[model samples]
Target: MRLQAEDGDEQAAIRAELEARAVAGTLQLDAILALSPAAPSSSEFDFLSALGPVQRQQALRRLLALLRNEEGLHVGDASRLADVSSPNFYRLRQLWRGRAKSGLGFLSGYAGRPTRQPRGVGALGTLGKLAAENSAFELADRSIRGLSKLIQEEQSARIPAYTLDAAARHLRQNARNMPDVLAARYGFRILIDYCAVSLVASGSDGSLKLVEIAWVIEETTQLILAARPVLDVGGCVGQQRATRAARWYIGRCGLDVPGPPAAWIKAVVPDPVSPLDRHHVDRMVSVAGEEHVATTGARRFGRLVTDVIGPILGRIKIIPRATLSENTSAANVRAFGRDILDHQSIRARVAQSVIAHNRPIIDMLRDSRLPLLDAGDRTGTMTSTLNDLLLRKG
Candidate 1:
């Protein structure tokens, strides 16, 4: 009975020693919890929990090294506490230092290759160069497969389709090889024209309605000044609408249109032979001048309109889709006009679109070394005369 009791006590002591060794080797959850109340619920904790025992041990050892560094514990003491060799402790310290230098990128799971020489970096570069060159020539043609084929044939490179597609999109959106001669030459003096876009509103009950869009462009700068939507009850825009639009544009821009002697405003319109059209133009000529208001034949005017405004308007997503449709009802038309086609709403959208389109032009103009035209100074005398007329009328 005495020998049996002694054996039982020896077994208990052995079990206690095993438990102490286990506790010494393992990370203290209570200590971690005391340090950070939210640690148990954090993503780092979850990641650690998801890892296998061996990986978990490695990660915990590194974490212990980091904590020891933070607490200003001695390296040798920290190594002993983590049950790691001095070499491993120094390596973990280096990893912690790397984390501090590279930010959270050091934790990213992309261990295949560095970004500078990624798995398909050569193929991606080849695709990007081809895409940029092609995008310059064909602004609208962006086919990823076609670009991949071209790169494969031209450079003997085999790039992944998704990689090529991503590269193509990046090139197409960012490439700016187009010449900015207009922006370089003309700062802001521009020409204005109106185009009637036929739309099938859901409320129009299958009937087509005309919405007039005014194209204000700087001829020399080739920069789109504005694409304003005119709310015209009449299907066609006449002299009154044109004059009003011009006046609104001038007022909004805070421009001083110099009188007859100096041509502050230069406009090219379709020649009008009819007495009524002539009368309308004569009034405008009085405001601008006969020299500034040149008239061209229908063919020439049509070509000019197409060349100047087609490309600019083609880039807009809303303009092209404004087509006739049988699904629209009269009530829908009224609602659309009130909600989407209202003067204020349309103007606001136009202003936003134009601002985006003009950014490059503005940048080019800012960087341009060309001499600017002194339109205001050249036409000061005419401006004074017009001011007098306004005062007299008032």
Candidate 2:
């Protein structure tokens, strides 16, 4: 074609027309919209701006093929051929497809799949509405039950290994002047103190494991409810203080309790004060150790809740087939109908829901307060054995 010049003429008009067509998504409208919004804009540019250079060129080539095809096509026909919607093709008209539109929604120079009627739903007819309703109910029931159990498990404690281990460590460290039985009692006492500190620390930092946070919130709420008649009592200073602090913490965070907001308890706890003396320090450590062991049992309880409720979850699986069969017998009807029910879309949605509901539980598993104990057990056992050997040699 002749080039356009500074002066307006036939060549300039043709150039202007071509530019408009290019902007309209002349041929590969479907392909253009499929591109990221950033794909290239000019036909002479040889690429979709949204696509990278290499893919842009490839897209250009595909558009060119669609443009050059001699068989005429309507917007609907073009969409069917390109596996895109007719509406998308229209939007792409000015943005660039492959070639300019020869007519409204019709590709002047293309021949592709001749339109035909949609396939029959005979297989689906066999299942009718009854089977779908039944399946829906079953899935709903399972999902609700599974979700309820999952929530309960995430907020409770069951195992006490950490609490116990903390106690043992404290006793070992400071039992020089005490009998073994007396040391054990001191160790247990230390565990309780440590547990209190840990709870306070976790509450302060909003870093308690999700289940632990939930438990704390629930227990604190219950305590507040139970103490309504005794909030004015002289002995309830610690209790009242803790309750007020917790409520203030939650309120300042602008979060409602019994939800993910409970996880913030760890962030609300104040930092530990330094031990006033060696004796006090030892007592604090011993108490904290015992508390850690007792809290470990919470994880076990969480797991049990998960086990009990997991079965109530909804499940859906999709299956694809090459083509519908000619046979319409009862057995064939049942089998084919079941196969069609396997839709990947439904499964994907379910996966999303599960992730959303179980987020807190997963977060709990990652808390630092709840490190796995296998490594600790191995180290402790090895240390004790080596110490025994050294003592014997001496």
Candidate 3:
């Protein structure tokens, strides 16, 4: 039967291409670049056509190169295949290394460095050589110095003056006062709003930005300040009492309190640029202190709880035997609850009394993930928007 142009035909074409490539021992990229006689029309599929034939071919070649070199290609081999010098190759390699370590393997493979491919004077080789010559750290330091000079010039300051030092001091002072000011200005409502915004922003941007985290931190710190009155009045005398009272009334009931610090999240949360895994969450929980994590779903809650108290158990380094489940420990659970509930702000947030906060403005940048995405997307997240400044082939 003749296939429908919209779905069936496209599926058939794709399948045929896959089968043919499988038979020909070509990569999927190679098969696609080969171009089918029954290729979809531009009107029917604008996205694929937008790539154009030349671009498709180039992309396909890069893909194949990555597949061949990813595993076997070392620093030297990549430069040779990219047709770049050793120095240039080093830079690309570092960029790739940074990407891979950050959980962005998809980007590394596509940009350069595929599995087991040997590098020896290819299209990307020459670029690699150039990159090795330019170091990212050196580039960042120079850029900072240049910015300092420019700011000084704009202010009509002395030639030898350093403005960065002053800026740093000012920022630090502001950060110190930020917690109290937040409580006075926004209150609990703004704190919740900020957390919601942070979640959305973090997902949209691929990774959380400094500003997003800062908002959360600021809101959270303020929330903590607001809760002081309740704590001061003997609302709960000791840590255990606070935990029990909070658990009885607030836990998961949506109480709203100040959330964990940005520093806590930054230290705990794994690199988002990389692929997600259960282990990453576990590691985060270990650092986060189980008391601080709020349980939502059942298994997810258990995991979060374990993550909170896991470190204190001293069993973090070792997996428990199946038999240990029978010898349950109530003390551990009580301790976890008490430890978390003791902190008024933390308890409020966990109990849903207040919104979980993000990083403060000053500490916002300590764990930003934009640079990884920029490097992956070919859009320069760090360095500069100076792609046009650099010499390149069309």
Candidate 4:
């Protein structure tokens, strides 16, 4: 009993001294870490070492705590402590995890992006790379690329990126703007009515041979706004394909959208570009001329364009479905022709052709515009074209 009291009193005194030091700011960052017991850690701190010892220690402590799931640590706080954006911080963490457990692991990998142009290096490389730099500018004013080109030619050093990004992203746009600009003269929406073009591959393995393209193009501007590839066919595949294409450009191109709570069939237009056959084309066109769009025998397959995707889509009157000779808009004619005939070539064909068609318009916007087919209301629903946009019909 006497020995136990003496030991307890000794432990209390030691703890008091430790607490006093902690209160006086003498605690080492290496102590009390959430990580596995340290085994002689290296002094290295990787890219963060540039933050200097004081800042780095603070960041490292917070990071280890956050990883430990300590009481109040959070992702945002962790990122701030590391003095990096959330994305960059995640990238750094991933790099760290792939290597040794030593703190010196930060001494390597993921050199930061270069801040300035490398003297004689070209202003840009591929469209994919260009898109990474400025998706918004690619989404807007086609002239932006021309401007970039001119700038590169005159002075190799390009303008600051944030300035350009802000200017492009802030451009005013709405569901009604496209109609006011492109369709005011025509007084109606122009939709691309067509089908799949079998891409001729050299090797001919027979997989992904038929590439159906559903794309949205801004007519007057000759801009293929958003495009997604549909590698398959039949049933409601076109519906999803069409809806995805529209969803990308709908709001961006001044057409508001979504579909498929219950898409009521209105018409089944044949692939004007490559119809299945003469008889099939004749039959479909004849049926399309009827009083109401037919939905007969539609049960076996998936949603039709008229139902799931077309209604929102059928309003892009920037181009006309009329004969190319009669279609006055050059942008419309270019897009229609590109869709019908230009998707050929053995190597780098589709991407290159698409790039040729829509160079300035970079990666497509991915915000949700339409609900997936039959996502809501089992009985189904319909939509109406409003100001070159589609609204759910009440």
Using lDDT as the measure, the top candidate is 1
Candidate 2 C-alpha lDDT tens digits along 148-172: 3332343344324333222222222
Task: Estimate TM-scores for all models.
Answer: 0.35, 0.18, 0.22, 0.24
The residue ranges of model 2 lying beyond 4 angstroms of the native Cα positions read 1-7, 10-54, 58-123, 126-132, 135-137, 140-394
For each candidate, C-alpha RMSD in Å? 20.8, 26.0, 25.0, 19.2
Candidate with more favorable, higher lDDT: 3 or 4: 4
**lDDT by residue for model 1 over 154-258, one digit each (tens)?**
655565665555454434323322343332223334454544332222223443343445455554444554455545432123434443443344334433333
| CA error at residue 382 for candidate 1, angstroms | 13
TM-score of 1: 0.35
Q: Which runs of model 1 end up more than 4 angstroms from their true locations?
A: 1-190, 198-208, 233-278, 283-302, 312-340, 370-394
User: What lDDT tens digits, residue by residue, belong to model 3 across residues 1-394?
Assistant: 2222236577567545543443344423424423433332323211222232433343343333332245355656545444456786555455545542322122221121222211221222322332345443332223333433433444433433323433322222233234343333221221100110001112233442111111111122222211111222121122113222322222222222233222232111212223332333343345444554332232221121122112111111111121112222334333322221122322222322121111132133223221122112332211121121122212
Give stretches of model 4 more than 4 Å off: 1-188, 196-198, 201-210, 215-222, 252-352, 359-394
- Which residues of candidate 3, in runs, are more than 4 Å off? 1-67, 70-77, 80-85, 98-101, 105-394
Candidates sorted by TM-score, descending order? Answer: 1, 4, 3, 2
Full-model lDDT for every candidate: 0.42, 0.27, 0.28, 0.34
lDDT of 4 by residue, 271-363 (tens): 333333333334333423343323233231112221112211211222222311233234543443232222222112333343333432222
